[model samples]
Target: MSVRIATDGSATTVTASPRTLTVCVVITTEERAEPSWVPQLEDCSPALRRALERVGLQAGELWLHLLGIGLERGAPTAAELVDAVAELAPAELRRHLVGVHVPAWRALVGADTLEAAARGDRNADAVLLADECYYGGRARDSLSLLLPLSVAQTKKRVADVLRRFHNEVFAAREDELVAQLERDVDAKRARSLSPDALITAATRGYVYEPEPELGRVVLVPHLAARPWILLCQHRTTRLICYAAEPESAPHAQEVRARALKLGRALGDEKRVLVLARLAAGEAGLAELAESAGLAKSTVHHHLVLLRDAGLVGMRGNDQGYRYFLRAEGATESSGVLGDLLAPR
Candidate 1:
């Protein structure tokens, strides 16, 4: 049987034969404007678009529904937000819909919103508010645990829709059998993870020790160390170590000159400089911008490119995200510049 996927701006739907699955990607735009909120819609939007694309659904096959809510409150309460969604969503869509809210302040608010959506006692379909719920907090941890549960429920819904569609439209009795097989496969994958085995594997790693004879570069792990070049192997995921020595000053200067020339050739001098700086150590975005002589936004844009190229890495702490060069000899860069920068 054929399947249909549809979306309004706020919600998305995927329908296969016996089941229809409705997902609310965004609950309201007003909550998005909160002072405490950080915009992740850029990342989320791409992920949702990709998921729909993978399932072969185009814009025409999806419906778009917009929730017309104004942004006045610092952050809307779960109840207020839910009322708005229920009012806007069609009654037929309500029964099949699953809301995904990005809570702005408390992740528990997201969980609360999900429960509210399932009950549908309010005027709205349960608003999923965008908030700082997925950062390094208890809510973030809780949300991670909830992900698998949500996936399981959604899978079941889709299977049910497919089974019904096949029987009614395709006149196929094997539809249920096919659905069961899919469920079995999913179950098998889930059961393969044993907690005791995972714990044992994690505890079996050796202590960190340096191999000085491996290269001229010394990794002190000092907070003030300058950025060093790292070479990463893409396939094996190993880093090749290399130290930039004081004696290598002339070569380093030449490499910098070459980098500048390459940057100019690519019409992106700032990016090249940013990559060079990150290869040296963890620098603030502002510092990187100043060193590269570019605006902060421009520096960020360049960093994104460097990050996508696997020349840079980022880790988020409580304060914010810190950018650094991947450690030398940790990744496999073999013949590429990723390797050229590593300690040898």
Candidate 2:
């Protein structure tokens, strides 16, 4: 199997250096579970909920538009972050909010589309609809809300919502949350694993194969994102927020969970076929799709299950990620099952 290292002299060899990849552990109030809007309403504080309604800002919208606050260096307090929002240039705010740096999307939407949309240009809707990624009702709703407002108006609304959110919702828990997130970051750094291993461990076996276009990976630990890993994309950086490993479960329960998950992942015939293909060599999504004679999306689903079960690893080049079997995980699956079946 071939291993790909970061080409920018970040590390000489993956095995030789713990920091083989340029991975940064970031902590910020702006790091919400992605799409930032989908968490259950009951999960939100009454103050936050009211603020959302007051401004017609979905919880996700406020964060989606303000996440640039997290991208800045030197973690700022929640109050400072809220204040930073008020100071961003209208164009800068929009750019940061809509960090959709996809080549095709950019080609279709053009350089001036965001400002045009802010200016209430009618053609902006048509341009946005051209991309399949924006076909969703959610995207339409977000566009509706955003496109109607001038950029300056959008900035004011975002700043106001964030200020209220900081004062009412996050301020109380900010220190405690920051402490927990920092502790996770420090503890993970203490492990001194290579970037590949660090990401896999922090994300509980989910490997982020960095493509040629990606220069950096930022891992942020978020308390509100428990039981889920969140991904956000910037021009050259990918931010991943993962839940800290739960300590509350009994050891046996944890083992049983792992064993059962492996069983379920290996139980599927199509997934097994995908694994078989990976065993021969690392392959991209299209190749796996063709080998399995399934749609790309179907193959992608199988990949997710296999990856979650720790049965697969991936590497990236200029084109995209190539999936390979992780021999360690495949070998460990049997031992996991054996432990569950063995005498307690």
Cα lDDT tens digits for candidate 2, 239-295: 566666444368788788787668767888999999989889889898999999998
Span of 10 residues, lowest total lDDT, candidate 2: 16-25
- Quantify all predictions' global Cα lDDT against the true fold: 0.33, 0.59
**After aligning candidate 1 to the native by TM-score, how far in Å is the CA of 178 from where it should be?**
18
The runs of at least 3 residues in candidate 1 whose Cα sits more than 4 Å from the true structure, single-residue gaps closed, are: 1-267, 328-344
Could you give candidate 1's per-residue lDDT for residues 149-198 as a string of tens digits?
A: 33334333333332332233223423443343234223323443332222
What is candidate 2's CA lDDT for residue 265? 77
What's the TM for model 2? Answer: 0.66
- Candidate 2: stretches off by over 4 Å: 1-39, 42-65, 100-110, 118-120, 133-144, 156-172, 204-215, 223-229, 233-236, 248-250, 263-305, 317-319
lDDT of 1 at 159: 32
Worst 10 residues of 1 by lDDT: 217-226
